[model samples]
Each structure stands twice: as structure tokens, then as C-alpha cells.
Target: MSLEWLQRVFGAKVLQFVMILFTYETEEECNTIKDDLKRNPDLKQLLEKCGGRYLTCNKMMNNQSEMRDLMKKIEHLFNENQQQCYTGEMPNTASIRKKKLESSEHQCGHTSEMESNAHLNLILLGKKRAGKSASGNTILGREVFMSKKSSKSVTRDAAVKSGTVNGFPVTVYDTPGFYDPKMGTEEIQKILDKVLLKCESGPCAFLLVIKADSFTEEEIKTVEKIEKLLGEERLNKTWILFTRGDELQEENITINEFINDTEALKKLIQKYDQQFHVLNNKIKGHSDQARLLLVKILQRSFGIK
Candidate 1:
């Protein structure tokens, strides 16, 4: 496939002339283009530069602070997509076909499939009152974690809760709040150090719980501290779980639109490959939401569907 074809997804505002090129490419050609983009460093950098120019120009055109902030969010999203495309990590026709083929084989009595028997171990990490414990309860479809409204940190130590969700044995580790005034720095470090060992042996997904209402300054600092501790490799396994979906619903805002509105959240999400999920802890009968979350975790983290 031509590079022109891949350019169309950026839209007329970004790449007007290449919009029609994708209609004529075959599946094999498309795969070839992805391969070229991955292997050709010069080509990848050129495309990235083009995207950066568009983002810069767009920002310059917007004078209002809110519009400029929105542009920054858009820039993060665009740069993320561009980076994935360059690395051939973004979902394309070839990857979709491969996943479908694997799905069919798994369905055809592939009992030895590793993902089927794999355990999902999730560690909830966030600041105080970010809904970490509540999210843990929602994931297990039960009130296993001590979730309550309070100015003080409800969970004083690391706790483990286990249950089967969406056919996978799920283990959730609910930890103490980061930057809790009652806890010292050394105590917090000891707690996190102990929990890190739990993820060493199994398929793990770190649920970085953040409230959907807003990304506060304390939340941003907490995220930075976590990233510093986990580093980039563990960060890749992390997913942003926005709690209190009910608030977003009450305001008639979709998660996508909400993320788009927050530049910091957008940057964080982009840094993590756009992996995120939303849960309404207030809502009863949230089993469906919990199951769907496990499904997503399986597909993305374990490459299982």
C-alpha cells in the first residue's frame, strides 16, 4: 500500500490529497506499507515531523486558553497514533486478520491455550480518594475492599482479594494511598515493594485508578511518583481506570470526550498506548462492567480474546 493511503486517516484538515488512496489497496499491500513504515526510520521521522507541524500550526491559530488546551490534548493523541503507526504497533488490517485467525484456532478446542488458564493479577495504584479500593470491589463484583468516603486513607496496608471474573482467576491487590498524610515515605515504599513481588510470577495489569470527574494536581503528582517507581516497562502494563462513571453520565459526557477535554489525562493516556477503562462503583449490578473490563485486559495484556 502507498504511504498516501495511510495518510487519509488524519482527515482532510491534515492530509487532503491522500484521502482516496486507501480505497484501492489490497490486504497484502497494506501489510507491506506497515512493514515499510516500521523498517524505514527516515520515512517514520518525516511523517512524525509532518504531524508535529500540523499540531503547532493548529495551536497557533487558537487564541483562547481553552481552545489551546484542547489543541494540546489533540496533539498528544495525534503524536501517540503517529508513534504507534511508525512502530507498526497500531491496529491495522494485518493485525486484525491475525487476531481473527488466532481466535478461530482457540475456539477449535485449543485447550492447551496458555491464556485460558492464565491468572490475571491486578495492582491498584493511585492517590487518596481516587477510588482505588472501590475499583477493586467493582472488579471482583463484590465489596471485598474497604471502600468508604473519608478524608483519611481507608486502606492502611496492602490487601489482596481474589475471585473469578469473566472465566479468569482474578487477583486484585489494594494498596495504601500514595502521599497519604498519615503515612511516612518509608512506610509507603515498604508497602509498594512487597506488592511488586506479587506481580513477578504472573500476568499482571496495574490499574491506575483516577476519578473521571477531574485530574487533580495531587493526582498528577501521584502518577509521576508511581511512574518513577515502576519505570517504563511496568508502565506499559498499566491501564488507566477512571472510577465514578456515573458522574460523567450525569453530565452527558462520553469518556472519549472527557479525556479529550483534559490535556494532562490525554498525555498520560497517550504515554500508555491509550489503554483505559471506566467503572461506576456507585452502580449496583456492575457485573457486566467488571466482566467487560476483564475481557479488555485479557485481549490487550495477554493477547487473548
Candidate 2:
């Protein structure tokens, strides 16, 4: 069920109770209720609290009849609470269904003190000469890696840099920009496999660098393929790092507006629910913004506060 559905039925307190039920319920009848709760825990818990209970009679015919009656009562309770919560508005069915799938994928885990102190792992990806290396340096607040202007990719392999940002640790991975179109599709797959192996686990967030003055069709294609290779939902863990945002300021146009105006850019944002962050690698003062953005990305990835 969508988070909206959860909120509508149980607010937040009882929703937490339903989560506990999912963790503890194991009997056949309780498991069935738990499965229903998994879909709409808020609704199930609210119904149970409001004089609703599972009834299984000894007689087979009576058991079936009672199950039907209990289901109808449950539905009625849900409808009543939904109206009270939404005030005459109907919930979006698609959103509710999508949220059910998302909820299943997200396992609520306990966070230890050490895990709370963990830094976010951000991987930078783009075409050659897209200033990916410079962006990393800017985020580190120093020239930690070589930023070359040669035609070949300066980062021949994946390299990681870790540092503290506003008291939270941040690790940025500088990777080779995949730009060779002449190579066969299989070769590109091999290259990506190697890169993924080097990364160990996929980075928590991907920073797709695009030069402020230059946006190319190749960059768009790269983003699309990456989205396909990693499921579309994975794009939520991405932030567009537009290097040289200072140049956009020089033009008296905000990078946000410029990206919104471009159809290709708009498509990327829409695909990821408008989740994009801009960084001016040349601006020293704005590095904090980049760090803050990383924190937000990490929170989303790990479901941390």
C-alpha cells in the first residue's frame, strides 16, 4: 500500500504497531492478516482496534461464511476511515499499488550507532571531459585527484576518496567516463561488469556529471542505458551533478530552470521524480551544498533520518 494509504488508515502510531505485527505474527490466521497488513497495515490495524477480529468456526461451511462476513466488515471499516482521513477524496489506485510493491522491497532494519555514523558512497559517471574528476575534487574541498584535459579518460579505473562533510563522512568514487561508441555492445557490457566488480556493491548514489556549457546526446543515451541496466527505481538514488554551474550564473540563468526547459533533461528528472542536484565545481563556497545533497541522498538510500 502507498504511504498515503498507511497514513489515512492508522496515522503513524498504529502503523508502527502493524509493523510490529508483521515482525511477530506467525500463525496461519495471523499470517494471513499480516499479509493483508503488508498491503495496507494502517487499514488492517485500524479495523482490528475498532472491534474487528478474525473468526474461524469449527464447521467448514460456517467458517467460510464467517470469513466473508469478516472481510466485508473489514472493507466497510476501511472505507469509513478512508473517508474520514481523506474527507471525500478517493485514493489513487495506481499509487497505492506502486506503494505496496515499494513497501515490500523496503525492510525496516534497526540502525546501530556505528551504522548511523556511516558515510554515503557516491559514484560519479559521465562521458569523458565531463569534469567528473573536477567535481570530486570540488566536493573534497581540495585537489585530491588529477583532473586532466587530454582526449583519453584520466580515471582509467575506479578510485575512491573519503572525507568528512559537515561531520558526516562522505566517500566519492571517481570512475572512467564511458564514451567509446565504436566499441561493440558486448565490450561495453564487459567494461561495466568490471566497473561494478571494482565498486564491490553499487554506490549508494550516482552523480551524472554534465558540463554546464555542453550537454551532449551521448550523455542522454548513457543515462537512459544506465536506468535500464539498473531498474528505473534505482534512479531515485541519483543526482545530476552539473559542473561549472558558475557559467550558468554568468548567463543570468539558473541551472534548475535551464534543465527544466530542456526536454531530455526534463525526461531524466521525471523518470527519477525530479531528483537532481547541481554543483559548481569552480565555486569554493558552494561545496557545502554538495555535501548536504549527499547527506539527503544517503538518507533516502538507507532510510536513515
Candidate 3:
């Protein structure tokens, strides 16, 4: 909902593309936001100030087909812009597929080796208020995505931001939380479909974010829903990213100790061959926690080591 992140990474032109998609829950809502944008003179000036013509957002009002076409157009433009900066950032999808097919036999159920120069796509997934958004900011080492503590979900749609982490081009997709009462089943499915498309970049690391303190019945059901959505095939690409390590530290408990004490958590980690990382989002500024986690992800998920 915050344009700060979009405006910071991308200019106002991309914001037009994002504004259309962000409020695109229903045709009615999309139309309402479109009308609002039209009436806002400052928004018009903002685009003009950025040397961008105001377009596409109006075109999306007609039908879903138009909206879909606009999405593809904007996404291509965005990726093209991003690829211009980082050398070999996102590899050709066809070549990635070919390489994965060739290396499938050697991959013992893990994701295939990523292109040497390819960027890492880290998809954050979990229940609402599980610190997924905050973890995203932590990983990026900046507050690009909005984060706060509230009963309501902060991220209502899928938002992405990219930056270099430890010299690797990393893009983080912060998705809406699972089992969010605010979101309908169909809406959730649409989000999943979009995210899966991004995953085609190849060798994505699916970080299942959860609080470090407790794993309750609700958390158990949430994990089941995540597994079902990801499917057993993607289990290899998944890793448990436990947030709020500061809480565990307060109680003099290690992440491993917390998991060992919780039977469900212990078994879940074992299910993924002990692939996990703990992040203390409270401890910001020049911390190596995020860097270390990326290293582990690259080594385990992408075979970068």
C-alpha cells in the first residue's frame, strides 16, 4: 500500500503499473482506484515530473484481458530495466530450463545449480503477522517494504524489491500472509499463480517465515496450508526462516534449542533435512545475520558453494 518502496527503487512510471495491480482485488475496486488517481492532480504532476507519460492504468479499466496485457508489458519493462544494471542478473528462462533438465539426474531432489551470474529470488511465505515483511526489510538491509505490528495484515498483495547482498543480485518477493481472513480463496490463488511465475527464474529459495517463540496449533495448520500450496515437489527448495531471534536470546535459548523443545518444529526441520535460518530483525545496522543466511541459501538451495 506504501508507494515509498516503489518510488525508491523504481521511478514514477513503474508506480503506475504497481498502482493498478495493488488494488486489483476486484474489477470494482480497480475502477474506484483508477478514478481516484485521475482526480489527483499531484499524481499527474508526479508522473510528468519524472518525465513519464500517464498511461496503462487507464487501459486496465476495460477488462481482465487488458489488465493481463498491461501486467506483462510493465513486467517486461521492469525486468529489462533491472537487467541493464546487473551483469547476467536474470538468465534466459529457456536456457535455465534446459540446464535444469540436463542437471536433474545429478540433483538429489534439491534445486539445480543456478547460473553463475544469476540473481537469487527469495520468496517469503507464512501466516499473517509472522514477520515476513520485516524479514524482507532485514534481508534487504533497508525498510523498502512496509512493516508494523497490528491485527490486520500489512501486505495485502505481492510486492517485490531487488538489491545486491554480499555481491549477489537478490530480489525478494514479500507475499500476503496465508490464512488471512481479509483475503478470499480465489484472491489467494491468484496471488499464488503470480508468485509461481516469478519462481520460474530458477533456483528460488522459498523462506517460510515464522516467529521464534512458539509453534502453536494455528501455526501447524498454517504449515500444512503452505506445504499444500508449495506441493511436495517444492519441499526441497523450501527452508524455515525463524524470525525474532531476539526473543529467543532474551530467554537464553538457541534456535536449535527452541526447535528441539517443540516437537512439531523439530520434525518440520527434519522433513527439510535441517534447512533453516534464524533472524533477529530487532538487531539492525551492519549485522552479518542476513549475509550469513544468504550464504547458507546459496550453498544449500542453489549449490553455489
Candidate 4:
């Protein structure tokens, strides 16, 4: 006889036979049978009885032990299929339990590299009045930091600037403005620790700002100290940013000409593999230009298309 005709003639008896076959097979084999049975209207209706416990058990049993226990219950129900107790209505239960189990299993194999779609956290580190806050605001395309003229360190705390640039999420962390001698080594170390914690994924780029008007001995020394802390290889990820580019207007000097003129600055740039950019915060469109340059530098350095 056809399976449908056989099931119709012997409703509970057929379910009992199917359950017997389900218990002997592996979980994968049982799932295949379950999918096949779902395509049939009569078998689905018959299975919907027996408290619909099988459906709940199938959804909730995530591990092997739970699956084995569920299989035993199904076997017992099949053995007593002719009894009236096996004909009860389905029970009420929340559906999220099964969905939660499925989702957890699906995410178990995910790795940190697989989750690397998170935004790159870039930090701007430099001396006070070096336009670090302005550079950050430019990158974010908004006034995220309070820039003032008093020169009392506008960014006292580490403020985070986050926004999407060209469809890529970019985070720029503005650290407390570093000044030499006045801000001791202990204070500087604290700032470094905080920056590392905030940019744990890795700082895609480090923008070290120096005023173009005059490069001092202290400035060079401070840059070297910072570099030592970040490590020599970190220069691959470093980009020298020359602030106050308007100051070079008197001589009409190009950024390359200016860099070549200063021995200390030239050496620093060369040591970092010649990664530098001139940023004029006083000009109208300079901020946007600097931000675009940084984006290009990061893409090239990190191979981010």
C-alpha cells in the first residue's frame, strides 16, 4: 500500500513504526526523516499530537546528551502509541529557546579575524597647540573637540571622535596634548596606557603633529621618546603631520622643501620611511585635505582596498 494509505488506515501505528526507525538512526538521519515527513500533511498532523513534545525536544536539544534523552522519550511514546495517553494536545512553550540554541551554535566557530569589520581606531598624538583637536574635528567632519586660544590644553582628557568617512567607519582618538618637561614621564606613560587600551584592535595610523613655524630641539627629543615607547617598527604605521603650514608662506616653501631644510625633521621622516603630510589648519580647505590624505595613507598601509 502507499505510505499515505497505510498511515490513514493505521494512524498511531504508523507513527510508532516511524519513531522506531528514528531511534535507531543517527541525529542527522533523523533530521532527514523529519524534513521528509514535514512535506506530508497527514504525518505532520499525526505528529502534532502527543503534546507536540517531539517538536519542542528537537528544537531544545542542542548537545548529544539532550538528543539521546529525547530519542529515548520518542521510543517510549512509540511503544505505547496504542494507549489513549499518547493522543494529548500540544503544550505551550516559548520559541526563542530553540532560536537561541541555534544562534549560539552558529557563532561558536567565529574568530577575531572574522570579526575584523569593526572600525579602525586612529590616534592623534602630539604637543599642545599642535592642532590635534582641529585635526580630529576635520577627520570626523564635525566639531567634536573644543578648540580655544588660551593654550591651556583644550583636550585635557582623551576624547573619542567616531564617524564614517567614504563608507568606512573611522575612529580618531584625541589624547591629552603632550608638552615636554612640564608633563612628566609618569603622566605621559599614563596617557600611553590609556591610548593602548582604547585602541586595542590596533591604531591604523598615528598622526604626530609638529608646528611648521619652528621645529625645536625639545620637539625632536619628544618625538623620539614617543617613538621609542611605540617601538621603531611602529613608524610603518606612523604619519608625520606638519601643522601651521601657513607659516611657510613668507618663503613660499613647499612641504618637501621645508622637510629637506630641517636636518632633525628630515632624519625623523626618513627613519619613518618618509611618511609625512603638511596640514595647514589656518586655511579654509586644509582640514578636509588632511583627512582625505590620512584615509589614503591608512588604506595603502593596511591593504584595505
Q: What is candidate 2's CA lDDT for residue 52?
A: 48
- Model 1 off-target regions past 4 Å? 1-117
- Candidate models: Cα lDDT each: 0.73, 0.63, 0.75, 0.65
TM-score of each: 0.62, 0.56, 0.63, 0.58
TM-score of decoy 3: 0.63
Model 1: lDDT equals 0.73
Better of 1 and 4 by lDDT: 1
1-305, model 4: which lDDT tens digit per residue?
12333333334344444432233236686677678677977556656543344532333355677678767876666566653342322111222443454467558854332123335677788878778887776666667778766647777677887885544567888877676445776787788778877675554678887878777977877687778777776678888877766777766988888888889888887887777777666554324565566556755556543
Q: Could you tell me how far off, in angstroms, the CA of residue 211 lies in candidate 4 after the best superposition? A: 1.3
lDDT of 2 by residue, 86-115 (tens): 332233554475466446644554434324
Clashes of each: 1, 1, 0, 0
Query: How far is 108's C-alpha from truth in model 2 (Å)?
Result: 13
lDDT per residue, candidate 1, 60-96, as tens digits? 3334754575556556655655633233433364456
Specify the poorest-scoring 10-residue window by lDDT in model 1.
16-25
Residue 249, candidate 4: Cα error in Å is 5.3
The residue pairs found clashing in candidate 3 are none
Model 3 score (lDDT): 0.75
- Provide the clash count, candidate 2: 1
Model 2, C-alpha of 263: deviation from truth (Å): 1.4
RMSD (CA, Å), each prediction:
16.9, 19.1, 18.3, 21.7
